[model samples]
Target: MSMPPPNRTKSAHRSPALRPVGPNSLMADLDLPPPTNPHVQPVLDPIFDEPDDHGGPVDPVVLAAAMSNLNMLQKQRSNPHSASSSPVDSGPSSPNFQNGIPLAPPMSSGNSSSVPGTPHFGAQTELLKALDESTKVIRQNSKAPTRAPSVSGIGAVVEKPDYSEAKIVVAMVGLPARGKSYLSNKLMRYLRWLEYNVEVFNVGQLRRTKARHEQEAGKGKADHSAKFFSHSDPKANAAREQLAEESLEMLITWLKAEGGNVGIMDATNTTIERRDKIRQRVARDPNLQLLFLESVCTDPAVIAANVALKVQSGDPDYAGMSREEAERDFLSRIAQYERVYQSIEEPGISFCRIFNVGQRVFMNLIQGYLQSRIAFYLMNLHLKPRSIYLSRHGESIYNVEGKIGGDSDLSERGWQYARALPNLIKDNIGDGPLEVWTSTLQRTMQTGSFLPFEKKTWKSLDELDAGVCDGMTYEEIEEKYPEDFISRDEDKFNYRYRGGESYRDVVVRLEPVIMELERQENILIIGHQAILRCLYAYFLALPQDQLPYIKIPLHTLIKITPMAYGCDEKRYPLPIQAVDTHRPKPLRQRKNTLENTPILSAEPDELVFQSTTARDYFGHLPPLSVGTEQVQEDVSADTKLPTGGMIKTHGLGLAVEPGALKEALERGQETGELTPRAIAER
Candidate 1:
C-alpha cells in the first residue's frame, strides 16, 4: 500500500506576516484573477465581520465541520478566477455550503434599523463570527506540543507523572538464539538508566543450568538433548514445561513484592499453548499488564551469524565440548524447536511482532509511557553485523592550553590530523558510502572536514557542559577554587560543577543518539571526549564508577563491533605527536613544597635524535619521555619552577587557600568518595 503525500499546512499560530490573508485585507496587493462570469458579482468579505450572536452558545462539533469544509475549499479545489473565490464568502447560491441548518440570524439589518423590508447583509456576517469563535477553540487545543522534553536542555518545565505503581510484563517469543537475551539486556540497561525498576528472568538459562547439573551428577535417567526440544515427546515436554512455569513463578513473585515495575521473561515462548499458560497466570493481577514481543527471522545468513556467536559464548550446555560438536548440538536443538514453533497470533493480546530483524514492525494494542518507550527502542535494534567507529575531535586551541570546554577551532597540528582521517577510514572501512556524524562545535566540524562521506550534525553530540569552568584550565580552576577541584577528583562521574552538568547527565542526553546509532550502518562518530565516553560505556557495558575514567585520547580511533556474546574492541593510534596538555593536582600552599620532591624548570631541554626504524620514513616515530634519578642531587643548582598558586583570569588573579583545600580532600576521603549515583540511590 502507498500513502499519499502529507498535506502540509501553514501554522495558524504563526507570525502575522505568515498568517492567512483574506480578499479584503492589505495582502490583496497580489493581483486577483478575473471572474469567470462578468455578470456575477464576486463575494468579497473578511473572515471575521460584525458580531451577530448576543452571547448565545454555539455547538463546537457543527462549527468544526463547517470550518473544515471552508479550509478544504480554500486550500484544495477553489480557483481564484471563480465567482465565489473568497474564503469567507459562502454565497447562498452555492449548494455544497447549504446543510439544511440555520446559520444566519433571523433578524435582518433593515429590521433592526428604522428602514423595513430591506434585505439582510448581516447574514454572512453572523456565519463568519461563529467560525471565528470556533477557530479560537481549535487553536487553543492544538497549541500543546506533543514531543517529550529533551534530556539535553536545562530549564525546561515538564509535567512528570508518578508511574511507580504501573507494572509491566514483557514475554519474549521467538526461536532459539533469535537475540532474545540480547534484547532483554538492552532494554534493562536503558530502563535502569532512566531510574525505572526493571528485571529480566531468562527461562533458558534456568533450563541450561538444570541440564548441566543433571549431566554432571548423573541424576536424571534421560539426558537433555535435541529430543528434549520435541513437542510430541511427553517426558521431554514435561521437563521443559516445568522449567517455563518456574520462570513465570519467579516473575510473578518479584512483581508482587514490588521488586520492580517492569519484568521480562526471556525464552522461546513459540507455541500458542505456552503463551496462553503464561497469560492465565498473570490475569489475576489487576495492576499488571502483559505484552508479547515476538522476533521473526527468515534470513539464513543472520541466523548463522547469531548461532556462531552463541557457540563462541560457551553456553553451559556446551561445557567441556569441542567447538565443532557444540555447534552441531546447538544447531540440532534449533532444528527440533523449529518443527513445532508457533508464531504469536492471539487476537486480544497487546504485542509487538518484529520480522526479519526489524525490517518490518507491527504492533497491536500497545500504549502508555513505559510500553511506548520500550517499543520505540526495540524498533531501532537489529541483529545485523556492523561496527561503530568513535573518535574524539582533533586537538583544538582549547586543548593546546589544557582547557576543559570551549568551541575553539582546530589548531595547526589538529588540521594535519584531520586531513589524514579520510585515508585512515579508507584503510579500515574500505571504499563505501559511509555516514559521518559530528557535534555542532567548530572543532568537531573542522576535524571531519576532509572526509568525503555525507556528514550530519547533532546537538545532542555536543561536548559536556563545564558551565562556569568552561574555557579554563584545570590548574587555573584549582588555583581559584581549590575546594571544587578536590570534590571533582574524589568522584568525577557525579560531581556536577556549579551550574554545570555531570557524567550521569551526559548519559541521559546520549540516550536518543544511541538509539539512532543502533538503527544506522557504518557510522563514523567524530565527537567530544565526554559525549563519546557515554556512548563507549554503553556498548562496553562498563560500570558507572569507571565511565568517567575511560581514557579517550585525541588522535586515536576506537572501533566497536557488537556481537551476541560481547562487544569486540580495537584502538588504532595515529603516529602524530601532539603536546600533552593534561594537568595534575596543584601543590598544597601550606606545605609550600611539591610532593615527591624534585627540582624542575619552567622550560626543559629539547631532545634531537635520529629514528632507527624504517617506519620513520612514513612519519612514524617512538614517543619521548624524560626521567632522571639524579634530579634530587642537582636540585640546589637547578632553576626553580613557578608556584602557579595564583591563576590569571579575566584580568584578575586569585590565590588559593591551602588549609581549605586540605579540609576538602580530607572530607572526601572520610566519605569513601561516594559519587552522586550512590547518593541518589541512597
Candidate 2:
C-alpha cells in the first residue's frame, strides 16, 4: 500500500518573493520552464488575515478543511521538460524541499572502528560539480549569511530593485501583567543565538531608573501607587509617555551607533494613541521596520501566574511592600490600564497577536523574511514549566587514551557510571515522563543503555566532525598542522578545520534540535562533549563565541529549567572517576614565546617535544570517586600508565580545549608547581 505524500504547497504566510519570476530569471535564458506556482492560499488562514473572535482560536474544523484543500492543490501533471519525471516531483518543481520541512534521510557510517560523526547516505561530489557552472554567476557576489539576495542579482537583465536592509524595532503591546516582557526576552535570546545583533529596551525599567535617581537626589517624591497608572491622571500619563519616548530614542540610537540588526521596545503599548505615537516616530526612518507584538491572554490561570511572578520578583513599583499589598496594588494598576486598553485595530501597521501563548496566533500585514521568522517563532512558545537534562557520555577508551571522536565502547569505569545514571536521574527528576536522547554514536548510546525511558538518537547530536584529522592525538596535530592549530586557537568559534566543521556550523545544524527541545517537556540528552557544550551554551544563554570552550565534564549531569523570561540551571556531578579533559582559553603568545607546551606520550618511556599544547596523557589518571591523595597518585602512575590504550587517534570529541592546554602546562604540568602527584608527594 502507498501512503500519501506530504503537502508541498505554499502557506498563506510564505513570502511572495519566494515565488518564481521565470520570465526575467536566468531560467528564461536557459530555455527551462519555471516550477509551477501553487497559489493555494486560503482566505481563512489566520496567519494572513484575522481570525474570528477578534484574534482568538480559529475553528478547528475550518483549519482542517483549509489544510486538506492545500494538500489537494498539488497537481500531478507530467513535466513537459523531462519525460521520465514521476509524480514524486510532478511538473518542473524540484523534489527537494518544495515544502519547508527538513528532509534529512537516514545515513550509514561506513566501516570505521572509531567513532563516526554524522554520515552520508552517498557521496555528493558529482551532484555538487553538476551545479558549479550553473550557479557560478550568482555565487560571484558573496553576501553575509541570513541576507537574502534579490532576483536581479542572479545574473539576469531584470530591473535592479532595492534589497532588504530593514533594521527592525519590535514594540510590545498588551496590558500590564501580561507576558509582554517574557516574549520579548525569549525572542531576543533566540535571535542572539542565531548571530543577530539584537537588543531590548524595557520602558518600565527606564521609569524605575528615573525614579531611583530622583530619590537619590531627594528632589522629588517617588510615588508608584496604583493612582500613578490611572487614565484620568494627566500628569502621570504624560510622564509615562515621556519615558516611552526615551526608551524608543535609546533603541534608535543603539541601532544607528552599533549597526544593530533588531532592536526591541519592551513596554505595554496598550492604547491606540500610544501605538499611533510609536508608528509616527518609526515612520521617520526610511529603513526602520516597526512590528507591534500583542500578547493576549484570556486564561485567568495564566494571568494569575504572571501577576504572582512579577510581584514576587520584587518589581520596583512594589518595593518595600508586603506580598499581599503588592499584589493588590499591581492588580489595581492593571485595572487602570485595562480601562483604556484597545484591541489593536491598527489600519496599515504590521502586527501579530499571540493568544494564550500560541494556542492560537493571528498575524496581519507582516511580510519579509525577518518579520515572518519572528512570527513563526512566536507560534512555538508556551508558558508550561519543563526541565531539560543535558549530559555528556561517560568515559570511553578514547578518553582514557587522551584521543577524541570515536564510537568505542565504554571502559570499565565508564560502564559503572552508565549503570549509576538511571538512579541519579530518578533521584533528581523524581517520577515523571522523562525521555532519553542520545547522539548516533556508540559512546553516547552506551552511556544511556541503562535508561528505562523512551529513547531517540539524533544525527545532529553527533560530536563535532574533525574532518581530515579524525583520530590523532593533540600533540600529533600541532606537529603536523601548526598554522591550523593556531588558527583554531585564535577564533575557536568561527575556525573551520581544513575539511571539518566550526562551532558556528554546529550551531546551524542544531537549529531543528533546539526547536524540538523548546517544544518538548522533560527529556534527558546523553551526548558528546562538543554537542553538549553547544546545548549548554544555548540553555545558559552564553555568547556564541564562548561555546568552543564551555567545560562539559564527562559523567556530570546538568538540569536546565525553562522560565518565563530566562532559564534556571543546576549541575550534578556523580560519584564517578572520569578523565579531566578541560582546557581553558590559551594566552596570546608570539612565535618563540610558545613555551611549556605539553606533548602526548603513548608510553612512559617516550617523550615528544615542542608540541605547543599539553595533557598528562600517561601521568594523571581520571579522578577517583572518593578522593585524591598521594597513595592514589602513586597507584595511578604505576597502574593507569601503559593500560593498553589506543594511540595516534584524532578528532575533537574528547580533545583538550584547542590552545588553553598550553596555558595549563605552563602554569602546572611543566613547572611542577601543581603536578599530578603533588598531593603530598611530588
Candidate 3:
C-alpha cells in the first residue's frame, strides 16, 4: 500500500517546547514509583507534564492506592486485551465510595488509617473510594475550560497541526539488473489494489529513449568530426543529464496537478548525489515526503542468470549490455551504490535494503533484521509494525498413518503443496525476500524440498518422538497397554513414550533452537505441528499449561513480530494442493493379490512411477500384519495407482487404505486380538 505524502512544512516548524521537571518534583513524588526490576532503569520523564495550581501534597493513603492503580494501568497497557480496565483520576470529586468515606483528594497526604477512628475506620477501603472520586473529578474537569489566567508565553498551549494533505514521493534505486523493475511493478500493483492514485516515472527508460532519438537525428553528423560526437561522448552525457532533470521536473508538475498522494520514481540512482537532488527538490514543497528503496542481490549468480534470460528476450533496458557485460556492471556498482545511499540518512528519507537470497537463509536474517528495524522505525518514524507471517508443512502419509517418527516421505499431495509454496509465499508477502526454516525430519525435509531457498536442516528441529509407538496406529496402542494410553492423556506434556519422548521433553530440547531464532531477523519457520506450537507459545507468552494444547493446523503459515511491549502475529492458510488432497493409496493398503498386480506400473494421473527396481532403492517396505493374521504377499513387478486407497492387485503389493487399517485395528482391539506391546514389537 502507498504511504501518505510527507508534509515538508512540518519539518520546517520548531518542535513544541516541553516542560522539564526535577526527579523530586511534586508530580513525580505523587505519581511515580521506584523501579523494581534490575533490567528496568529509571526513565526520565517525558518532555511534558507541567505543574498546576491544583497540584498539592498527595495523601499518603490515596497516593498508595494511586500507585497500585498505576501499576495495574501499566500492565493493562502492556497487554491491551486484558480484562481489567484502568481507573480514572477524579481529583477527589468522584461520587463512588468503597465504604461510607468520601474519595481521597488527588493531592491528599497522611494515611487515612493513621488517624485510627470511625472517620478512618476502613482507611484502605476509604482511600480507594476517595481515589476513584478524585479520578472522576479530574476526568470531568479535563473537558472544562480553566478560569485561571494563562501562565504567559511559558505555559502557552501549542495546538498540534494536522497533515492530511501531505505529499509522499518514493524512489526505487538499485543496480541495473537486481530485480528493481520486478519490485517496482509489484509495489505499483499493490498500490493500485489499495485504490491509491499513483504515478510511476521510469527515468532510465526516458533517458534511453531520448538518447536513441537524439542518435537517430545526429546520424548525419561526421563520425570523425571533432564538432559532432557520438551518443556515448561528453556532449551526449550532458544532454542526458539535462533530459533527466527536465523529465523529473515535468513529472513533479504533473503529480502536483493530479494531486495524488503517492509518486514513484523508478531509476538506477547509482549515486547519493543524484537521489539527494530529487529529495532536495521535493523538500522545497512543504507537503512533500521522500522514501528511498535499495535492492541488492545476495546471490550474484541468480542475477547473472536473470540478466542472461532478459537479454535473450530482447529487453530494451539491457540492450546496451550483453549478458556478461550487464552482470559485471551490476557487480561493480553494488558496493559504491549501497554505501552512498545508506550514508544519506535524513528524517524524510527512508532507506530500506532489500536482500535477494535463498528463502531459508533469508528467513533467519529477515527475522532478526525485522526485529531491529521495527524497533528503530517505530521510534524514529512513528510507525507501527506490520506483516508477520508463519507457516508449517502440509500433512504427510506418515502423519495420517499414525507414525510418530519415520521420514517415510510426503504423500502425493504433500509434494504438490511443496511446489505450490513459492507462489503462495510470493503472492501473500509481495515481492520481498522471505525467510524460511525447516526441520531435518524426512517428512519435513521432503515437504520443503521444493521451496526455493538456502535451507539448513537443524537436528534439534525434528518432530516429537513416539518411541515404541513410532509407526503404530492409536488402536494398536489402546489394545496393548491401555494404562499407558490413559496415562499419556492425563499428562500429555510430561508423558514420555516407552522409548520416545514427551512434549515437555521436546520443549526443553528446543531451548537452543528457540534462542537462535530469537536472535534472528525476519524469517518463516517451516516446522512440524507439535514443535511449532511450542515456538508459538514462547512468542505469545502463553503459560506452560497452554503449550501442549496450542492447535497448529496444517498448510498454514504463521508470522509473529516482537513490538515495543509484546508480539503481533498473523496467519496465511495455504490453499490445499490438488495432488495432496487426492493422494494414491500406499503400498500396504490395496486388495490385489501379489500375483495379479505388477509391482512396477505407470499410472497416467499420478506423478509417481512405480519401478520394481526402485522399490529396493528406498529399502524394503515394512511388512503388513493384520492382528495375528500374517499375509505373505509376493512382490514381483511394480504396480501404480492413480489414487491411493484400500485395494490389492496381483503382482503388486497390498495398498492399505488409511481408514481401513484404522478400522481393522479398532476391531482387533475389541476382540483382544492385537496388543500395544505386540504392535510395538512388530
Candidate 4:
C-alpha cells in the first residue's frame, strides 16, 4: 500500500478572502442581522451529489436551492460585464478608481425598497451583488477550446480583474548571508502556491552577470572584492548604485507591464540612499506598495555558520579562491558593506525586521492584505537545519482488498510493517527529537503506535475522502461511475470526488499544516497517499501538475533535510511486503458520470494525536504546547527591548544594533521557528 502526497496542518487562521461569510459565521460577529431565509445556514453543505460513509444527509425541500444561487455567483464572476451582471463602473477616470472597484450606484430615488412591503429589499439586492462579486468558480477545463461560450445563460468560467491587489515591491534590506535569499524563496514558494504571481530580482546575481559580461568583452575584470563594495571608493559606490537602480527598474517594469503581483528585490538595500531610490520609484504610482525586510542576527554562532556556508558554495565572489582566502575576502566584503549600511528609518514606509531568524520580528506601517501575509509568514520562519520524515501508514485491510479510501484496521502484514517502523526510525534518525503525527484514522495511528515519540493527529493527514465510493475497489468504481473514473484519470489533481474532496482541495486544506511544519525542527508524519504527496511536493518544490503523481510507497520513510537554498532527501524503505494501492492514469473513455452518487452528510474528522510511545517515554523531547510571549509593539525612538516581549512603547520597533546583522552573516544556526503564540506576538 502506498500513501498519497503530504498535506498541511490546521494551525494558521484562514485568509479573509477564503473565510466563510454571512450571519451564521465569524462574519456574524460584526452584528449582522439574520438573513431573510433564516433556515439557510451560512455554511451550507455543497451539492456534492453523493452520500458519505453514513447514509444520505437529512435533506430540506430546498437543499438544491442554494446551488442555483452559487452558480449565479460563479456566473457573475466569470462574465462581470454581462448585461445580467454589469458592475457599477464609471470608467478608469472615476474617483473610486483607487479602490479598484467602482462605487455602488445610488438606490432608486422614489422607492424605499424594491419590494413595497419589504423595506430592506434593495439592501438585500446590494448584499447579494456583493456576494456575487466576491465569489469565484475555478475549473481548469472550463475554457477548453472545444467548449463554446455559454449561450444558455450559464457562466463563462472567468474571474473579474481585481486591480486592488496592490502591486507590491518587497525590498530586502539586510547585510550579506543573512538568509535574505532563503526568505525570498520561501516567500515566493508560499505566495505562488496560493496562486499569487510573485517574482524576485536579485541584485547580486545581476551584478555578477554584468561583471562576467564586462570581463568577456575585455571591458574590465569581474571586480568582486572588498574594494568593490567600499563606500569610500567613489567609482565602486557609483557602480553599485547603478546596479541597484537597474534591478529596481527591472522590478518596476515587471510589476506595471507584466501584471506581476509582487516583485521582490532580493538584495542588501542596507543603506538609506539605496532604499530611498527604491521608495521614490514606488511612490510615483499610488497603486504600488513597498515593503522592506531587514534580517538582523545578533547571535554569533548563527553568523559563523552562515559565513562558512557562504564561501563553501559555488559563488562568483570567491570563485577560484582557497577556502581560507575566500572566507577572509567575504568577511572583508561584509565589513565594507557595514561602513555605509543604513537601516530603514523613513516614516510612512512599510518594513519588517526579523531578529535572529524569527526569534522575534518587528513590523511597522504594514498595510494591505498581501503585506500582512508577507509579515505573518516571515514571523514564523527559522533557519535551523532539520529533517522531515514522511511515510505512509502500514498496509490496511482495505489495501489488501484493493480498496481506495476507508478507515480500515491494518492487516497482519501491515501490523508487521507498523512494528518495524520504530527500529527503522531509530536507525535512520538515531534518537533525534522526533514528533510523530498521524491522521485520526486508526490505520495511520496504529502504524505509528510503536514509535517512542510524542504523537499528534491532524485531520488533514487523513487519506483522500473517496465519498460515496469509500469502500469500493477501483474496478467497482469503474463499473459504477464510469465517467467519473475516466474524468479522474484525465486530471487527477483537480478531479474532486463527488461528495468528497479533490487533490486540489487537499492542497488547500493542508496549507496551514505546511506552515506548522516549516516552524518545526524534526517531525515524523504517518499520513495517507494524497497527504504525503502534497507535503513532498512542497519540500521538493515540485510543480502542481506533477504533485499527484509522485510515488509514496508503503513502508518507506523519506527523510527531507532543508538547507539554505534547497532540500535534500534520503529514502529508507523497510523490508515489508504490502499490496499495491497505486492506480496509474487510466485511458479516457468517458467524460461524465453515469449517474449521481449517494450524498452522505460527512462527519468531521477529529484532530488529536494520542501519544502511544514505546517503553522509553522517560524524557526525550519537548511538548508541542504553545506558550505566550509579549513583544514590544508600536515601539518608536531607538531604545532597549526586553526579551520575551513585554512592551515598552515609544513609537518605532526594536531597532537593530550596528553590526548585529554582520553577526548573522558570520553565524548561521539558530532555534527553529517559534510556536503559534510566538508568531502571534510578532
Please tell me which model should have the higher lDDT, number 1 or number 3. Answer: 1
lDDT by residue (tens digit), candidate 4, 584-635: 4333422222222111122222111111111111111122121111213333
For TM-score, the strongest prediction is 2
Clashes per candidate (backbone, < 3 Å): 0, 7, 81, 41
lDDT (Cα atoms) of all candidates against the true structure: 0.56, 0.58, 0.43, 0.58
Each candidate structure's TM-score, on Cα atoms with residue i matched to residue i, is: 0.59, 0.65, 0.30, 0.64
Q: Which stretches of candidate 4 lie over 4 Å from their true place?
A: 1-166, 585-682
lDDT of 2 by residue, 230-334 (tens): 756655666666678778988987787777879889888866567777888889997788888888776654565556566666467777898668767887787
Q: Which one wins by TM-score: 2 or 4?
A: 2
Q: Any runs in candidate 1 off by more than 4 Å, and if so which?
A: 1-166, 192-198, 214-222, 254-261, 308-313, 318-332, 579-682
lDDT of 1 by residue, 41-109 (tens): 222221321123321112222222322333342232122211111112233443422442113211122
**TM-score for model 4?**
0.64
lDDT for 178 in candidate 2 is 67
Q: What's the CA error at residue 312 for candidate 1, in Å? A: 5.5
